[model samples]
Target: MAPIVQGTGEVIVIMGVSGAGKTTIGNLLAEAAKCTFLDADDFHPDSNKEKMREGIPLSEEDRMPWLQGLCDALKERIIAGKITVLACSALRKRYREILRLSDPDHLPGRHNCSVKFVLLNVPVEVLSDRVNNRLANGEHFMPPSLLQSQLELLEIDVSEGILQVDATQNPSVIVKTIGDSLIQTKASESY
Candidate 1:
């Protein structure tokens, strides 16, 4: 809990479809690590929010700019040597790549930033229930109807080095799992 990877320009991305508790888990992890926490939804343009509010699925074209902005923001934090935890629905391999800042063609310089992705893998039924509950409480703009589309678009590749956590567990458990994994990963890399 004492700053997981301080001054190491580490970016931890908590990813999954809506209702997977990305924001909640990400916030808790960041707090435990004593770092910055960011919710990707806040970066969405008003148009995108409106579309989701209307139960419309956004296309790849609709997401590129937003993703790019997130990448830029993350890059800045990395350069500043800040540890940042981002909660985002980085459902696609391409989107994850962008967030990783792995595209040499677009990168301004060699950034020694370490980006770790944690996927919150939850059961569809649980996701549905969570989304529905949020909808009923008017707590979010994303309607429950868009969940299916998000699930369909989700693509995970083992080669991405993503850490998958069973999201059905309690939020604290999920955070501890991720934190332990990250610590182990960092330790291994030091060799």
Candidate 2:
């Protein structure tokens, strides 16, 4: 699923580098859609956070369980017919594939739910600014120190049906653009 996705639902995953505003915009998105908002960061184990706080990057091994947990949680909501927006640093294709398949109802035409990927593309300079602001206030784990690793893991898979947005744009404008797409998708569901 490189570009055009084939499933349906109100499951939208906001993804980007650490400082790309996933949680901020995701909250607005969840509010607009009247759905639950989940942050993947909360799913991280104590050790992972500790490692990042120490200015160390988490190996993929350290992230597997957390990623799986997020996938399972979202899958449960999809099963209950509940729509939600989640902030996940789904930076890799394989990681996303796991979440996309966690729903057993995802077989063939039976799955009327979708997992939309909205990628925020921010320049390194802008990401630095965001991280700087965050650190000044007390945010850790996403220190500017970890930025290189995030960019390294960041993959541009346009064929995966992702909506790529420039992170430099105003958050409200970005959310509105995606909101229109969500509205169109919901309207088609009643058919």
Candidate 3:
């Protein structure tokens, strides 16, 4: 991991399982902070998407390259002095570490940023229902079958600048709760 020149902005990771509302919360956080919003899914290669499309769950090996992509994107934006809020499925501690360290492509301006991870958690039933509804839309490549693997891989590192929120809660409530936490953490100092 390459340390950034100087830390100028915060990197908030909205993380959780597929239906945990990471996208919504991350987008809201980005809007409130007036920073760039990045969807981690966009970094996935067609092959990975194809795997998911075929209902084959992605292993950690499958995710490392994608995680590296995230690191690169975050590293680039951090170097350019642009704050970014990312929605990712950083399930394990290793995954989190890789991102925080900007592994693989540890650029010059990668590690010089404050990082906060927010986990959106909900009951499995709630998540299952959400995934079902999402699938009903017939657009996402993520299969409901992959949800179990994500749940199993998830390791809640609550002390690593991680905050936990109930995903099944209303969107406004979730956003407000997270916004308040961001303020309390001084992550929104520029806001």
Candidate lDDT scores, in order, read 0.88, 0.79, 0.78
RMSD of 1: 2.8
Q: Supply the TM-score for candidate 3.
A: 0.85
Can you tell me which runs of candidate 1 are displaced by over 4 Å?
Answer: 102-113
Give the TM-score comparing model 2 with the true structure, all chains together. Answer: 0.87
Which model, 2 or 3, shows the larger TM-score? Answer: 2
Give the alpha carbon lDDT tens digit for every residue of 1-191 in model 1.
55686765778999999999999999999999999999999999999999999999998888999999999999888778788999999999888778878322334322333777899999999999999999999999999999999999999988677899999998888989998898888888789
Residue ranges of candidate 3 with Cα displaced over 4 Å:
1-7, 103-113, 187-191
Tell me which of candidates 1 and 2 scores higher on lDDT: 1
Local error of candidate 2 at residue 166 (angstroms):
1.8
The root-mean-square deviation over C-alpha atoms between each candidate and the true structure, in angstroms, is: 2.8, 4.9, 5.6
Write down the worst ten-residue block by lDDT for model 2: 1-10
Which lDDT value does model 2 have at 145?
94
RMSD of 3: 5.6
Best-matching candidate per lDDT: 1
Q: Ranking under lDDT, best-scoring first?
A: 1, 2, 3
Query: What is the lDDT for 78 in model 3?
Result: 64
